[model samples]
Target: MPAVQKSGTVLIRAVEGAQGSSRGLEGEVRYVYYNEPVVTRVEPSSGALEGGTMLSLYGRGLEEGSNLTCRFGTGDAVAGRQETSTMATCVAPPRPVKDVVWLQVSLNGGADFSGSAVEYAYEAGATVDEVRPSAGDSGVDGQTVTVIGRHFGSGQGLSCLFGTRGRVRGMPMTSTAVVCVAPRGGPGAVGVSVSNNGVDEGQTRGGFVYSGDLKGKSAFVYYEGPERGGILVSLNGGADFSGSAVEYAYEAGATVDEVRPSAGDSGVDGQTVTVIGRHFGSGQGLSCLFGTRGRVRGMPMTSTAVVCVAPRGGPGAVGVSVSNNGVEGETASGIVSVRYEYRSGMSAKSVGRSEVRTGLGSGSVYSETL
Candidate 1:
């Protein structure tokens, strides 16, 4: 059956006799067609408030005519081109406010498309007000610097730059707050910038000061860097960092500053210690190494901390090191060091008696001389 031109209930009567026979039996059939257009999705869901965005609507039963109208906020789309029954294209008009607007399309100039699947968000005019802890040491692991500003809008397509070489992006809290790591840098004032969907939005003047530090912080997070991912950073105090933090995949590096349960007994198998630092990936494959005893399994608790079990080892002032599998980059690897003390205990020569206690489990027991 062909599609109906209009919509309404229709009743058809069928007569069983000749046209002149009024006494013949008769039957009736009813039919209805839903001609209202259905909108499934809108392309490029976000655009600048200044408008002039080419938007495409995908759906079914859509026809372009003199009565067809498309509205975005208070502005009406211009030059609507109907491609097919399932697709249409138009240019978005300028909007006065930054918000999520319903995309309305009418086929008969009387139908409303509000509360439909089509929605567009105005995301232009992003600005950066300030960066907390503007000054930082280069190659520091897991230092969280916050960017405060307006029109951040979900921070989905945001990115940032710290200095000539240091850059980081991640941890979006809201439209007003974003937290990122301090990338590796050299001695100088670093520029900062925020970008939304590849367009530069704001810049800060001398926002971050970097010191001359050659050591790289061992970061364990899995990030593609500014090239593929970003967080909003401003320059002048206000635009992009001078260098690319993502270029070297430096977000995986971290710097160790503190450790807990720093001292433990020798040959202990299950001593838990916390490693606090920056850029630790969430539950990433982290490991610990004490002296030359080998790798100890660890768990990344947060972006700034990790917990690991101390492995069996001799007593001495051994250094504690942490590593992760996420720091595979061309520039550097993820690794950091801190000191841990292993207390002296009984030596092997102090053993006196060996008890063959097989019934007390499948292990041997020995007594140590006093």
Candidate 2:
């Protein structure tokens, strides 16, 4: 069948034979080649892009004088739709929705092909959930952020879109979480997305919001040095730590690899603590928690030793940190006794994670007593 432009549309002509009229009244509209062009194939389909793109339509029975018309949705037909004898190259006009539609083509001979628009369909996945950290947390550029949403495992494009001029693509996704690296994004928060099929419009009702930066508070501190997996030290019960971690495969197994102050010595205001451990990828920095309001950091390090300031927080075995630089790793625990505190006497003792480091310092301070 053939398609043509007629009456502002693609028209198809069919031949009919009448026994009473001399085998089709010679010429006119009845005696022409008959058959409407059918949409046989669309190469490189799925017109789901914002920039300009081309489409190739292939069909059988294509003859001279064929015209193709394209439209998005059922709205006003697109103007200036073009076509060749065998194919049509029409630019897709703006659409009011994200959907599937048909491109109708008509042959002057006698055939018409009206096909619906193409859309991105994720065949095997669905929308999952989303995750956001507590009130006072921050993410850095190149740090992995997880978005717990479903239907992202199909290995499609996941773009963490900023406002208008900026975007980061390839956010790794699993069935539960879609992980993306921060791109030094501004305005503090942006939209969590599984591009082409994440949320409804541009809403983040169930998406991740990135907090401002917190790395400025980190002081370069003790590290056992480089390895494959990431090295780690713990501050809270189950937070990702730094140093000694090779690939950041560090888990909540904060046991054997612990940081400790030199034996028989008490942590003073300006003393450096000695650290010991495993899995420290590249120890970034550390800090201490004396009895203060917000956390702070002091001494920074590239190697083992981290200089720490006795936090102003009231006594107790205040927590010390082996601060990791957003790298993944298992955190180990250690202990340090705090002196000169508001809470009076009985030098506080802290075990495993949950120890608070008020400010920046290096080395491990909180551990268990044998």
> RMSD to native for every prediction?
16.3, 17.1
For residues 1-370, what per-residue lDDT tens digits would candidate 1 score against the true structure?
Answer: 4567776667766566666775534677875444667788887677778776677898887764435567775556445667888888777787787799778776645344534557888766555666664445545455456776666655555666655553455466787766667676655545565545333434443255543442354322212123323332442453434343422222335556667756767877776677777765543446666656666666665656666777877878766666554322112233445777777773343443332322222322333232
Instruction: List lDDT for all candidates, in order.
Output: 0.58, 0.38
Q: Write the per-residue lDDT of candidate 2 for residues 276-347, one digit (tens) a residue.
A: 432222333244333232223534433433334443443344333443433221221212222222234434
Q: Candidate 2 lDDT (Cα, whole model)?
A: 0.38
Cα deviation of 97, candidate 2, in Å: 17
Candidate 1: misplaced stretches above 4 Å? 1-37, 43-48, 52-56, 61-70, 80-91, 98-101, 106-124, 130-145, 155-170, 181-338, 341-370
Question: In model 2, which regions exceed 4 Å deviation?
Answer: 1-111, 114-128, 132-140, 163-165, 171-173, 196-203, 207-370
